[model samples]
Target: MSELIQTYWPMIVAALVLGVAVAWFVFSTSRKTRVTGTSRDVLDEGAAPAERNKALIDSAPAATPMQPAGGAAATPDATGDDLTRIKGLGPKLAATLRDMGVTGFAQIAAWDDAEIDRIDARLGRFQGRIRRDDWVGQAKLLAQGEDAGFAQRYGKLS
Candidate 1:
């Protein structure tokens, strides 16, 4: 029995060590793969760099012509108005209007139906909002720089 134990002791130790190493390797590799796989799943699958860049570019406002160059009226400087003072206009629409070169109450108040349609068409998701919210009337009142009527009618200043 002692001889048998001595003969097989080293082999037993080596077998135990090999088994532990294989188990450790399998578990570690599976754990790493699971972590990476879950992280990949959490990331946006459709969000390619080119598509994301294109969406950003598309969302960016284009440079709009404010007034005719060298025409009858002198072009207004690029300084913009706070179009948000109009009751219905939030900051986003105000920024969009400013991007479209609509910087003053005079410009908005002066819009005829055709001009309104043209501008409204440019308003993207805000189409028909001008007519619905009476933006022209609001502009007319705001252009005068007196808010008495506007406040009475619109309930509050923006």
Candidate 2:
């Protein structure tokens, strides 16, 4: 047993670290509430980015989680624009953006240079992808319904 402990100590230590990380992630996520604007439905559709951001900032405190009277969650939480439509963005990146309160093409399209830099700093391994992939350009095309141009530039969207 003593010999085994010496040989496997590194693995045991790694497992313990992983366990702590998972627990911290779970606890942190559970404690974070989704901040929303006065009209999530309207804000997500056809609205310009600056207007949307302004509204969200002004109305964030008034918004609450959408729990139906019937004790079920709202459908909006599960719905958003298909972010994967942008070529370089994968599932993990999309989830990270969602966690950061991004949901629609319009939202991403609206990011200014400052916002891009700010967001890029938080992307960890995905840093610079927003600029490298031209997320704003791709999102602009999609948000404006330029399918042919988007397909030509970034491949076909499903």
Candidate 3:
């Protein structure tokens, strides 16, 4: 029994030492790097309103006035109604539509069920809203310079 213990004791000690060494090496290597304020300072405090505004302006696409809620009015550029003009479209869905060749309302209105289904498959969560909202018909009316049925249905147009 003593001989057996002696024989394995060195192996056990060596394994313990190796485990400690590996643990220390892993911990030491995982130390976080200190980030200098260079990147953060550029974006953080002391930024002037004009500079911030300019940065925002530069980062953002050129502003188009948002259409009224429920797409009550036609937008200035009649060529293509902005899909994002719909109230429900978030940035992600709008981008998805753009990816699916649905850049305009006319395109959406012109799309058959198969094409819309394809778009819906890509859009996932936005599918139900797109179908329920009648986005295509609204888009078509907007494209045709109609007052979105307010004049006809309500007897007065905005």
lDDT of each: 0.77, 0.80, 0.62
Q: Say which candidate scores most in TM-score.
A: 1
- Candidate 1 — what's its lDDT? 0.77
Top-lDDT candidate index: 2
TM-score of 2: 0.50
- lDDT tens digits by residue: candidate 1, 28-115: 8886733334443224776455666678887957555555222232233577567888877899998877766677887787777877
The candidate with the higher TM-score, 2 or 3, is 2
Per-residue lDDT for 11-32 in model 2, tens only?
9999999999999999999999
TM-scores vs. true structure, each candidate: 0.54, 0.50, 0.42
Q: How many backbone clashes does candidate 2 have?
A: 0
Off by over 4 Å in 2: 1-78
Alpha carbon lDDT at 10, candidate 3: 90
lDDT of 3 by residue, 1-158 (tens): 99998989999899999999999999998896776665444445785456857888779576453222233232334444455655456678877665544566656666566655666676676667767766666666656667756245423432
TM-score order of candidates, best first? 1, 2, 3
Give the range of the ten consecutive residues with the poorest summed lDDT in model 1. 68-77
Off by over 4 Å in 1: 1-62, 66-78
